[model samples]
Target: MRIAVFTTCLADALYPAVARATVTLLERLGHQAVVPADQTCCGQMHLNTGYWARGLPVVRHHVETFEAALDSCDAVVAPSGSCVGSVRHQHAMVAARYDDDALAERATAVAGRTYELSELLVDVLGVTDVGAWFGHPVTYYPTCHSLRMLRVGDKPVRLLRAVQDIDLIELPGADSCCGFGGTFALKNEATSSAMLTDKVAAVTSTGAQVCSAGDSSCLMHIGGGLSRLRTGIGTLHLAQILASTREHPCPVPEPRRPARRRPSLPGAAR
Candidate 1:
């Protein structure tokens, strides 16, 4: 299958490894991964922040970029479920909001073919085991958009379980939000931190060496919290884990940052 890789903004700028892994895993499955050079952000940030008029051009550009590329590619795939969620759910809505029925129609066509990493892997590729081997205890956290919005239930787990020699530990409260709703962390720091605290505690309790999730954004938030609390847990994207193989294993991650005291809970012993 010929697939276009939609390297979302966060994956493009902050977590390029996740993007690379997405391509690697696909190619290993014998799929051609084409990354269109002109492709840019899907205007998720603008639409997500309620900037409809401002988001239109960005959405239009994405629709134009991928709709054209889709001419040669069988499907579009991204590592981040958040971005895919935006592509699948927001692009058309934003276009329709501005009364651009034509753009909305185009956006829907592009989105109809776009899939998140797990969605592409399990649903489209029609395979769970992609010949991966990772001999470590890892827990998978299902990102919110992928879980609630995309409803990509058990696909990620099914893939991880197929990894050779993997100890797939179950994450407590795995479906809870990591509180990194893009700008939500910055806008609501206290609430976000509290939610992250809960998530970090749950991850640490899993006794897994690494915390893995489908979205890098959530992993960043969870990783930061785990680092501060010195849980010694490293965060890895799902693609990275799936990309790992016995002969060419994933690189050893850098040591986690030093620990800090956990935030004091109300009426709780510190």
Candidate 2:
């Protein structure tokens, strides 16, 4: 299958390795992965923040970009369940709110053809085991969008379980949100921090060296908090784990630097 890779904004900017892993995994499975240069954010941040008017153009751009790639690609795939959920669920709503029925129909068509990485691997490619091997105990956290919005239950877990030498442990409160609902974390830092505190605790309790999730945003939130506490646990995207093999094992990610503090005004406090 000729797959068009929709490298979401977060993956493109912050976690390019995740997108690279997705492409590598697809190619390793003997499928061609084509990344459209025109692809951008799936208008998720804007829509999630209730900026419908501002998000319309972004939504339309995504539809047009993918629609243009249809001739060269068999289907569209993204590593992010959140972005896929936005494409499948929110794009048409943006169009409808703008009274663009024509665009709405087009967006719906594009959305129908897009698939999250696991969904494409299991549902479209019809393969569970991608010939991967990782000899380490790892736990998975199901992101909110992948669990509730996309309803991609067990697909990711099923794929992970199929890996040879993988000790997949159950994550306590696996379905709980990692407190990174895009802008929600920024808007409600106290609540978000409290939620993240619980999440980090649960992750530490699993005694797994690494925590994996489908969405990079959630991982960033969870991973950042873990890094601050120096829990010695790392967060990785599912694509990175799936892309690993006995021949080429996935390297443990380097520890992230804590957020820098703003400089104090000169001669103000001292």
User: Candidate 2: global Cα-lDDT?
Assistant: 0.93
Deviating ranges (above 4 Å) for candidate 1 = 257-270
Residue-level lDDT of model 2, residues 191-245, one tens digit each, is 9999999999999999888899999999999999999988888988999999999
TM-score quality measure for candidate 2: 0.94
lDDT of 2 at 98: 84
- RMSD, each candidate, Å? 5.1, 5.7
Report how far residue 54 has shifted in candidate 2, in Å: 1.0
Q: List, residue by residue over 156-250, the lDDT tens digit for candidate 1.
A: 99999999999999999888888999899999999999999999999989989999998888999988998877778898999998999999999
**lDDT of model 1 at position 97:** 84
Residue 85 lDDT in candidate 2 = 97
Residue 206 lDDT in candidate 1:
92
State the local distance difference test value for candidate 1: 0.91
